[model samples]
Target: MSTGGGAHAAGLIRLLQSADFARAFTLAALGTGFASLLIGRTAGSVTLVTIVIALDVVGAAILFARRDELTLLRFAPTSLLAFLAWTLASTFWSFDRASTLRGWFELLAWGLLAIVIAHVRDTLQTVRALGDVMRWMLAISLGVEILSGILLDIPFPFLGVAGDIAFGGPIQGIFGTRNMLGFVAVMALITFTIEWLSQSISLRLSIFSLTLAALLAVLSASPTVLVIAVAVGAATLALALVRRSAPEHRRTTHTAIGAVVATVLIVCWFLRHLIIRLLDAASDFSIRADLWNEILDWVRPRPVQGWGWHGPWLRGDDASAPYPLNVINFTLDDRHASALNSFFDVLIQVGWGGLLLFGGMSVVAVVRSWLVAGERRSIVHAWTPLMLVALLVDSMFESFTLTGLGWMMLVVCAVRAGQSRSWRERIRDLAEGAPGGHGSGSSQDPLSGAR
Candidate 1:
């Protein structure tokens, strides 16, 4: 009777960690993502954000209770907590203390949400869930763009619509900017390619996904994203080749990479002037150069803690730098907020200390993610790292590191790539043989694995 009762209790606990919960939380995450693109502190959007936080709260509760697969320590360890703590502390020094404090909460909340996702997913489910999110987001974006451009011929206020295709658009799609749209397309291209290479989807679907991603990328007309796409594509191809090589020849792959890096460094040193000239050839970049010069002057005074935790390009009354018009000598009522470089944005917002922390975090994340992705040639290995690369590339031209999808992506990838543990994890280690846990008992029969 005791043995039967124990078995029944275990079964009940397993039921609490069901796939149904996974599905629910996944959709909740998607909804939060969609709502975050809006303009405001409006109640509706706030409600959606609350839903995301609530789901995270519930997820953490369930996993913690089950002693199933919770990995809070590995997911958000000392570095992560330190970063969050510092960010929160900056509220005291912010120009607008209330806003900065709120930002801290918002960022931490998203980080928690990421931990929930990373702990819930395994390798395959991670990829599949990623696929579902990107596929549907892209599909919906296409529909919305078409409707705004052709049918309604007006912007959708809720989607943060900038303008329609009738204007020779730099079409902003649902993301509210041409560059952001291109960023999504680039990610889709990477993910869809992985799906294709992995044979996770039908050939026709893969081809269609590839074509759609390409179309969106081109139509968005974002020079930065296009350039980044080329770099990422080259990297992907190189890594793919590395994966295809035999295990015995894998060492040669590292040798080739080292050689290429050396040659590139040598060439860069020899032709530094020409490289500068080539970079200067872009007209828009020249404008940014002019502004950056002025931005440098303003940052000189506060090189330690910075102007405050305040971010974005538009410096209001209490901003660290001069107004965009003052910086660039351009006479336009509209303003450019970000420094066109995320690194500089961090420098101006939080100072050298913040910059070092953020920059270090970014570097560590990319390296960790790269290692994880290089473990195998499968799309699973490729997907997360490619996204990290895209994030890195975009940060060069946009202050994306502290905002929206970029921040969320960083947290998820970092947590997933990490390998750490808490004391409570002993409970998990002991429960490894249980269902929903990962250990030697996992998926020995490929046919029995979850689809």
Candidate 2:
């Protein structure tokens, strides 16, 4: 009787230590943050970002306190460590001190979240959790967008801060600008596609959600977002097709089709200047081009470690270069924010060494995820293609690395890599639980065949 009681207690403990708590906390953190983004007066303020970061930190602390029950910290592979180092170096050399400091704090919070996610959950569950968080975030963003459209006449609470716009219709959101709204909508669209492929819920529902998100994206009218959404969507679909093909036919078909599609896209982009034209539609595109050139010129003289943190732009007037006047104008003007491209911004600030280290780390992360997906048949495998496509799309027109979203996605991908399982393991678990294996009599053997 005592032995039975002890066993029962152990089982209860195990249940408590399972992934559900971590998943719930993650969803809560994301939901609150999205809500704040949609409704908070200070959309990008430290106060709002702080609240979410605090919650994540608390969640991580709890997981660490119960470290014996979690599996995430043990799975910190070498690539992740290298990535973290690169992130730290970037943080150290951030051109905007305040913005960079905020970014560093956010990164630490997310790192803790990643550890918790890895410790308590497997890859399939991680993807499912991410899907849930994104779904809720999308729903909230959609509600906010609709509200913005409807409440055009009166200052409707949080809508006031976003201000009024005249791009065919009112485009107001907590993000305070049409471009940011469009970017967020594009992210929603990607999440919608991922959820669709995972079949986490009904196909009909996924389709409906995706349609709504796409509509919102179009209404926002950011050409960059629209073009990226299409490109990433296409790439993700193609990769999915390849990944799901029969093993014998997959390699040849994937290679042939991938090469042809890539060649066609590259040819069109170069010959017709597809991307350039799309970017030209935005009023700020010219500014970005000038800015990129300015950064290049600045980097030429001080190639290594460039100018220290906040050096080039801050010392705009004094810096001698072809684009110094442009730099001075950009720095003095509040209308133009930091450089529009993240790579060039970092390159000018941190030089080749910083760029290579950070860029190499990002590449390693992508390669690791791909390799892991190849060995697994989980929802995480479905995530890899979408994530890669999204990253590529983001890199083209925006300073993706500067955004919190980029790090968030990276943490999610790393956790997925550590938690993914082999196809055989998934199959066996499914088979043993098809209602005929052992029933309730083998409660103690739930994972008997898993290993």
The best candidate by lDDT is 1
Error of 2 at 87 (Å): 4.8
TM-scores of all models? 0.78, 0.72
Native-to-model Cα distance after best TM-score fit, residue 383 in candidate 2, in Å? 1.9
The residue ranges of model 1 lying beyond 4 angstroms of the native Cα positions read 1-16, 38-44, 66-68, 71-73, 156-168, 244-283, 311-334, 420-451
lDDT of 2 by residue, 1-451 (tens): 9999999977755554555655676666555544554534544445666776677766666565556543432345455565455545655554445644444565566566665555555555555666676666556555665555455534455444332333343353555456656776776776666677677768987888778677667766676776677776676666666667776886686578668778977896676555566556635666776667766877897686644333123212234322333464555453333456656755765677656755664665555455444434554455654565566566656664444555555565654543342233444556877532222122121121221
Question: What's the true lDDT of residue 401 in model 1?
Answer: 58
Give per-model CA RMSD: 6.5, 8.3
Cα lDDT tens digits for candidate 1, 1-451: 9999999977766665677676567556654664466423345555655676776677676566446443344545455666676677777776677666656777777777776766666545655666667776777777777888788888776566645666656676667677788887887787787788778889998888888788778777777766678669867876776777787886788689769857876986798557546645366666667666766776787787766664554433244423322443344222566677878777776778888887777666666555445554445666666777787788877766566666777777666555422223435766665444322222221111342
